[model samples]
Target: MSDIEDKKNSLIEKMGSEIITLAHGSGGKAMQKLIDQVILGFFGQPNQGPLEDQAIFDLSAYPNHSIALTTDSYVVTPLQFPGSSIGHLAVNGTVNDISVSGAIPLYLTCGLILEEGLLFKELIEVIADMAEAAEQAKVKIVTGDTKVVDRGSCDKLFINTAGVGVVNNSLNIRIPNIEVGDKVIINGDIGDHGVAILAARGELDLQTTITSDCQPLNGLIQTLLAEGIPIKAMRDVTRGGLATVLNEYAQGVNLGVLIQEAQIPMKTEVRGVCEVLGLDPLYLANEGKLAAVVPAEYADKAVEIMSKHPAGQNSCIVAEIVEDHAGRVVMQSDFGGKRVVDMLVGEQLPRIC
Candidate 1:
């Protein structure tokens, strides 16, 4: 076995606990083990073994057509924010999730829980926003369900969306495609959605005019694919942020990832809030960003295509897969020091989505 494999095995052996804890949910070592031993170990499939942000199944030999399906729920508090509202977030989140899986999101089903005494005008506004976002994303709300609950039983609104899209081809983007030398690319600034919500809720002291980066990314992914760029896998870094997503990739591929903190895209205002709040931007949440693992040879082409698109204009190569530090994400700080960038165990800003 390689040196790194030996080391990782030894580390796992030494973790002497069988009981569950909140740290396991933190997206750190504890969570990693829980998923590896409990979830992935039992249910993982050959092609769908925890790689990619989503699973890709083969249908080439079966049916002539293939489909991609995904679901997501948005429970961001305050219902509305500076740049977008929970309505837009719910729709975009589901659309982007399916899009990054290399599918063309075609239809969505929305389920909403409305609290009693909700302002009728506000409900209409939210639906209007959802319609506008659906139009922009080129998807339709073909079906939906609505329910009303006591004022104290439910928040202002909670939205759950399920989406389906046709896979243009049988090629699946699984995480196992990530090799030792693949490049990591992020679409744009991180933590805008989380910080924006926090600011709107008066959770932060300082703020600038910044909006949530909530938007559909299917168009951007379509553009990238048309360019014939080789993307090993794709994921929208929403909850649990980029760090958690990278850690998920690392475990799936059994490879280590080293990212340069300097290369991560974060807006100045978001950075300020993270600093004041003592939160690592890596652990912060983002709504409209995506992480792509590309073959090293095609990294440049991928970045170029991404930069030309509106949602990915600031795309940059943040890191590369490595053989060492297996199942871990390490970051090279600006000060020339290295630190383990693990996932947050609990929600950093809960109800912010």
Candidate 2:
């Protein structure tokens, strides 16, 4: 959008082929031009500086704040999925990790691995989405590197990202802060991401109208923190899903977790898919979901505030920390029977970011 970005965009036009080749990875004009035009063009030069081996940030603005850092790699198959792509997932995933630590996501670093003969147009599209996701999360992509591998050496694409954030020096959200009678609240329905990925793979020959709830939650979480919700501990319901998260929390403080099945929200289609496949929705992955444990006194306020946000319209208290059955997670099913919800032994869905 600036004169510098305008100049950078021209480099993409200088590449030799519409598709990537080994030459693009060579230390030559084509590679430099490609990186500059793609990264700088969409992300804009961060901190008004040139790209270098490392990114620099001025700490003066964040004085009295503690720094939080996180990193993750994305290898989601089918690079482009129904509600989001690997690019968007990479950005949101890293941002969520930093945010769950009660930090304000500020900057990110992107590392890309591309297979030979990958489509040039596809690369631009992914980079654009990553930039858009970063902007939505109010963060910047500061630095990145790209490598091209031989065909069949790697998937079509793989992305690695690192995030940096600033947290209030006084705020420390951790499992140690959780206590008995604390209500467990979730932002919205679960299992959409896992089911969506399963459908995308077409390995099961399934059909559905489900879409991944892939969006940034920094704004939603920050709003509660700003309003003094007093969240005890919070975690993004990612890879291992809500069951795993609660298990971790319960074991962390050696307490019991009781979640009512009726209160755990899920879309009808997602539930139906899980039922037909004999899969438990409790362990289904989510990209844009989070579980926050707040005291009973603030539970109403927490749900009230969360439901107002677009990312948390179905927010509600699904469970609570208890003293009975310490060191384990229990669930009250719709049939009025109690059962133990154990940790996932093996991954239910793979490459599901």
Candidate 3:
């Protein structure tokens, strides 16, 4: 049989019947057939150097900087959402994790798990999305791996990405660096990504036009660093949303995080949906938003710079690091009341990037 026929017979082996063959998982002929064609066709770039087991990056330019590495897996359901896709999350999620560490993102590595019955069309669409996202973020997909599984083993697809970035040693952005009286700032509105996913699922029969806020934030971070504003700590608000992120800072620094409910940014549609659904928007996940604690002296300057940037047009101070109520997160309600914002107990939304 031809090599193509062998791959079709082994890699795609009768979908529901022993779908995962040795040929597909054992680096056999079937899997190798896909390397040059499928993987390279989508991820190949000019001047990528010779193919090898790993990517080699010259760090001579980063003399006194530190290298930052982060990895994340994407299993977001409905693969394609209103404003983003699993592919976008796979790239941007990893990028933001590095950027939030006050690093300059450089390269990325992708690993994909493809089910036996997944359509090439859908796979190609996702690969294209990842490539486009990487290009836009000014990062390169230097190396990657692909594997196939049984028809029912995994959902249609899953993507794992590892990112590399460099951080200046002169800067110290960490939980320990967060000090009381520092101002907490957010780039823009929150809860859009979570709401968009819920609306896309069509499970609640809800109606709204909220789109995912997934985007790379490296540019914003670079802008802040360029201006010489010192950042106490930064975190990409994902999975647990802004409330959980704030609670982390509170617990990390053993200080109080006081956020005004009225000062938090949100769209009217998102707020209304959360109210109707009995869901607190603060706990809804965000993709593009970030919560930053900056020195009191540079708080306004940071906000001013962030406000002018594309990613932070709605920038505002939503919270303050305080000495009162140590190791706690307190929110002054919009209705003249105060409440403790605890860390999320269980998963509010699963498979959400």
Spell out the clash pairs found in candidate 2: none
Q: List, residue by residue over 50-77, the lDDT tens digit for candidate 1.
A: 3444433334543554788888887788
Candidate topping lDDT: 2
Which residue runs of candidate 3 sit more than 4 Å off their true CA positions? 1-30
What is candidate 2's CA lDDT for residue 250? 94
With candidate 2 superimposed using the best TM-score fit, by how many Å does residue 69's alpha carbon deviate from the native? Answer: 0.4
After TM-score superposition, the amount by which residue 262's alpha carbon in candidate 3 deviates from its true location, in angstroms, is 0.9
Ranking by lDDT: 2, 3, 1
Off by over 4 Å in 2: 1-17, 46-49
User: In model 1, which regions exceed 4 Å deviation?
Assistant: 1-64
Cα-based lDDT for every prediction: 0.78, 0.88, 0.87
Task: Report residue 155 deviation for candidate 2 (angstroms).
Answer: 0.4
The deviation in Å at residue 2 for candidate 3 is 35
Spell out the clash pairs found in candidate 1: 25-345, 26-344, 26-345, 51-175, 52-175
lDDT of 3 by residue, 134-234 (tens): 87899988898888888789998999999999998988889899988899999999999999999999999999999999999999999998999888899
How do these models rank on TM-score, best leading?
2, 3, 1
